[model samples]
Target chain A: MTCEDLDRRLSEGARAADLAAEPAVATHLARCPECARLMAWLLRGIGDVRVDSARASEIARTGLKPVRSLPPARTLIMSLAAIVAGVAGLHVVTMGADGWPLLSGSQAIVFAAFLAVTLALLAPAWLSSLRPGARQRVHPVAAVLLLAAGFPALAALLFPVRLAEGLAAEGVRCVAGGAMAAAMASGLLFLVTRRGYPLDWGRTGALLGAIGGLAAVAALQVSCPRHEAVHLALWHGLALILPVLAGFLAGRRAG
Target chain B: MASPEQDAVPPRTGAAGAREALDAELLRLMPRYQDADRAAADALVLTAGPVLARYFYSLTGDTRLVEDLVQECWLRIHRARQSYRRGEPVLPWLMAIARHTRVDQYRRWKRSSGRETGIDGLVRQPSSDPRPGIENSLQAREVVAVLHRLPDSQREVLTMMKTNDMSVEEVALATGVSQAAVKQKAFRAYQAIRKALGVSRREENER
Candidate 1:
């Protein structure tokens, strides 16, 4: 057997003696000193090197002091949701919720449905960032990309406006408006979650940025006058990308 | 890779029962510790000291730094106690913090590599067992030496599993990665060890 095969077998729990009993493995072991050493170690087993912890308990007790635990995950989750809602409410209040009224009843319903689903999806990510050792099945960047694309995709598919003169000219302003809203919401989240030590800072930052971006998109959908499909889709997509990019960079920097 | 504890065949009494008892005790003490109970905090440090030491020892294999690292970890745990929710398994939280401490120590060491004494670089820890026997034929240093060549994250995953007798799920929880990621790192680490050992052996031969 090759040296790699021997290692694989040993790692798989095959006894060294049993492997050595085979002629090919023995021959291979005869030439490969590394394999031979590995076989010898496996045959004899290893000794435990003593670790000194005599003063650890004493050191630990001396350092003990007062500490207040964080609130429940639900409370933190609500606080995050509140940040988004608060930002959206303020945007709608200040800018006016005029765009949604421009759409048909079914179109408005579809838009609201998309926003609701996006919020539901994002809540767990916020909760996971707060809790240490939280299991994230999907990588953060992938999740961010999918969620970021979702808003614009909904806009592209549902709302197709005719190309009028200066149709997409106002898109940049809308994107900026959404970005500001995102930045504000994400900033509030950072303040509230300052005490939280996210194991994956990048994930936390990306999700934080995405939450803010989505809030801006939702708020702008209602408040912004332009309901043109390309305008909404392009600006909404840019809005989503901007905050996620900021958060990602921030997360990477923090991490 | 098979855990070192599993490979060693050492006579560890009530390993599972001991683990369960420790788990229960730590869980019981965590909430109290968070409530500013000095007595509970002391109890926690004392209880988790050995386990944390073993974990750090396995990851870094520097007995000298293990104590310091453990203490630093406890300080972090105390500071981040606010993040630890009630009724959660406390070891994962403690272990998760311990990992960051180890990582931070590594980063600091890397940053100051020009000034490092290089003492911690030596993973060749002397065995406590002095008796002349089969155990003497294979040193723990050699096993750790083979492990030392792995990438940091892979090495941490493998050594923590093998030496600490931690399961994949537990390691995943401690490291804040998926269990699949843990398994993949372990499998890759195992495959890499053979190649690493071969290279190390060649270097020694040339010397």
Candidate 2:
């Protein structure tokens, strides 16, 4: 065999099996000094590479701090339940005379559908945090968030209303309430799942943020008597942005 | 020319079996270490320390730096112990963390120094001082020096394969690439090293 052909075969042979055991390569190398030199160089180079473990004992003596245990999945689920309860409690305390406007009729169905979608999205994030290597798929989180935010816009088309319903006046209160509720929920999630090694922190944070924002929106739906599409779209729909942004920031810092 | 098929023989299954057994044992010890058992932690260090040190050495070829990286890798492993699943293979998981730690350290060093330390940094200068008989061989030193000339991706794959004895699937999992990609990188790395060594040999003959 030509020198180049022998070299290529030896290299390819090394990848699949031991080069030394290849009889033809061995026979050729034994006769060819230059090929022998190359073979010797490759074998010795890999063989001579050695690691000294003199400091292994010293490093072991340094004594590592015990890793903190991840909170149980049950605790995370419970905390979520608590956040829902707190938001409901806040709604009961601050709700205006609109009492049960969104709770009745087709509005109730839409509200329930929104809550179901939000919970479904949030469930995976919470479960993933409790279990390492359980990464939530980004597509689902994005889809759910789009649906949750765009629901108001969809409603606006179905039920057109007068543009100036004084919804802008109540914007500050709605945003403030939503932010407070989101913060509470996010804080609880962050505390419980902080120890987790999320494969993607931004995704996790965004999921948690969505959960908080959706919960706040649901609470607002029950408390705020205004059924105006503009009120829900401009004020309530926009509140989710706060949590999403906060979550992205928190996730970046986490990793 | 003799085709490889004509010369190929059955691989030695005994060696493969032994390696599998060792990996299984290491996998078993990971949970104990996660549970805060100091002895388990120490044992893990002792068992995996040499392998990790060799991995770093293959990357940087700096003994002191390799030692420091090994320490840093262990520190990360300790911190992320809770993230490890009980029954999964430990080496890939550990290597994944070690890989990230090395990348982070390299970035930090680059940022601080405002300089890039690539393959050139890993190629050690021939030492004048007397060394141990076997290790002092000139051929081995020359071959290792040539390895440092490979690109980071190729060098990483070669190191994981040659030094750590990781399978393509394991490397793919650790490096977050497909198995086909790992094999391609390994083949490319081997070709690069062989071509470079051939050129160097020809240059020596002319000189």
Candidate 3:
């Protein structure tokens, strides 16, 4: 047996060794001080760690019944991405594509592409909030926050900044419609991930709100005719931001 | 920490070692537990007890905290049981929950106490010379005489490996990092252990 075998046996406690009977074990022991050091402790009979069975009961108690596991990450994430697409697309179709005719062909393509990439990038992080050990390329909160900031900046570069009459009033109408879509998206996202075991409620809640906000912004991009930068920046930005704050509060409460 | 269920997992034969057999058994128990099998759950707890306790003790070095963490870990594990997939290695799922438990507790303690406790008192261990050789005790702080020389990540990998005879895939999953990361950390840890052991052997040869 190798030194690792000896280590395993030592880890096994009692029935661990027969130094005189196994020359390989003895010779390796003679050479490796770390194993020998642990062996010395074993010889003193203080090596075994004995914990109470009451502790085991705590574990068994939790597993006492039938339950289904969550679906694969790909399934969950794809469905979330689908939620963004379905909800935004449905809203835009019903509301009319007035903004499409107004935008330069290039302007429309890049804006639509940005929204598509944002949703795609976010799908993986969406899975992270559902499982404690899931891999995260970027934190969900940070990702959502970046979209909140980045989208407004992108709109400023892509759209006109001309001050329009009744900008506040028109902005409110646009934000109201966007906020409704965000709330709907948030509700659906929550429903999809309802079974998830979020290690942090606030972060999960924020993601929930962010998804709603994203659906609204995407919906407005096509349905709302006005392409003015300030309207998009002021109203569309709030549409996503408020829900995230609300989601964080709700998540903490649920936690 | 040994339990009756320790005998309950299907016994290994041929090339399978005890740890491999145990891991296989754990993999089987997880799906059963999801299906609500009390026996499987009991077996999982009994078999995993020593490993979880060792994982915590190796990290915190406090027996009391280990007990609390184990208990808390179970509650979270039960609530999060459904989050585990049907066929994934089970230890990673379990260790991830155990880690969450530790971090949650640490946060609560920090919030309530308003003072930072260094991750453990291990960092506070006295270093006055006498340079004890490798035969020193295997208590949490003195495992290798140079374990403290390891950064926490490397030390954590070594302890987890020792805890369950965990393979790289299991450790990588448990720590939620890439397998390459686990290898690098374990490599660094073994280097430290060997250096400490080599020094002791050189002294013995000189004598």
- Model 2, range B1-207, lDDT digits (tens) per residue? 878998897544643554576587788777777666667766787678767866776677655666578878776676677777667777777787777778767766777878777634533553322433213345534644666778888878777776666777778767756667777787677667767777888989999
Model 3 Cα lDDT, one tens digit per residue, B115-156: 766544333242222222211134434553345556778767
Those runs of model 2 whose alpha carbons end farther than 4 Å from true positions after fitting are A1-15, A18-163, A198-211, A217-238, A251-255, B1-15, B114-158, B176-207
For residue B184, give model 1's deviation from the true position in Å: 3.4
Model 1 - which docking category?
A: acceptable
Q: Residue pairs in steric clash, candidate 3?
A: A65-B36, A66-B35, A66-B36, A182-A212
Model 3, position A47: C-alpha lDDT score:
32
TM-score of each candidate?
0.74, 0.67, 0.75
DockQ of each: 0.31, 0.24, 0.24
Rank candidates, TM-score, best first. 3, 1, 2
lDDT of 2 by residue, A129-195 (tens): 4443343333436544675666676558544565765667787788888778777777776766666
| Local lDDT at B137 for model 2 | 45
For candidate 3, the per-residue lDDT at B121 reads 34
**Which pairs of residues collide in model 1?**
A70-B82, B3-B162, B4-B162
C-alpha lDDT of candidate 3 relative to the true structure = 0.72
For residues B77-132, what per-residue lDDT tens digits would candidate 1 score against the true structure?
Answer: 76677788777777777778888887777767767775664434634353334433
TM-score leader: 3
